[model samples]
Target: MVFAMLSHAAIAQDQTVIEIQSPVLVIDQDRLFAETRLGSRAQADFEAHAQALAAENQRIEAELIAREQELTELRPNTAPEEFRAMADEFDARVERIRSEQDEKARLLNRSREEARQNFFGEVAEIISEIVRDKGAVVVIDRRDVFLSADRIDITEEAIALVNEKLE
Candidate 1:
């Protein structure tokens, strides 16, 4: 039970003017990636991976619980010094496991972010093409814009094109 003691623990807004000199398009970039085939597939893949990680954590927790029980059982018969060393080694092992698991979680989050960014990059060219076709100079995230007129937004159009063009 002593080994269990050691291992533990653990938005913004704004809006801007609509009509500028140059044509501006707004994209719900989140929606765009979330809707496309590539984005959808990436998301599903990452989610599955995340679930696997969760299962792994649960498994580790169970194993640790069992280890703690075993250690507790041995504590009474063992010599004080020997038990202390055993506890210390057990603590060290737990620390390493924690560090490794934490790193894995970080890597998972980083990979998810990187996948999102890469999806955005892949869609960027599609966005550019739409921009050129519409004679727009700049595109803004839909969430950022304070106000905007209808028909100017090319998010839906971009999504359509992205799904159509990319796998």
Candidate 2:
């Protein structure tokens, strides 16, 4: 009876020692955006629009400077009331143009953000497939994890898949 009890205890210990695989995984989301082709194209588009806006700003500034110079030249010869009215109109135009340009800048930023959000949405199915393949129950952003084994960092693998799967 004593021998049977000892043997049963040993078997229980062996069963308890069986390895349990980790269900969590990590991905570097920023790396996904920078490394994937989809992300690169989006970034390029945003940058191009931003550069165009900057050029437009410079052109508007040049035109305003020219207008101001013309107004200043006219001040000496023109009637005082007429010159003052022209100056006020110029100030009003400057304010209106400035407001419009600011709105464009804001819209550009908003579009970029929407593009980023759309990119992530496009990648969600890919991530889901990866999670299924890896038998991972949950995937957390790498930035959120305090410490994790490098083996669990799937950003590069995911990037390769994204590049292959996406245009």
Candidate lDDT scores, in order, read 0.84, 0.90
| 51-146 per-residue lDDT for model 2 (tens digits) | 999999999999999999999899999999999999999999999999999999999999999999999999999988888877788889999999
Model 1: per-residue lDDT, tens digit, 6-44? Answer: 333100111223332337888888889889899999999
Please list all clashing residue pairs in model 2, or write none if there are none: none
lDDT of 2 at 9: 99
What is the lDDT, from 0 to 100, of the residue 95 in candidate 1?
97
Query: Which candidate's TM-score is highest?
Result: 1
Off by more than 4 A, model 2: 1-21
RMSD of 1: 18.1
**Alpha carbon lDDT at 76, candidate 2:** 97
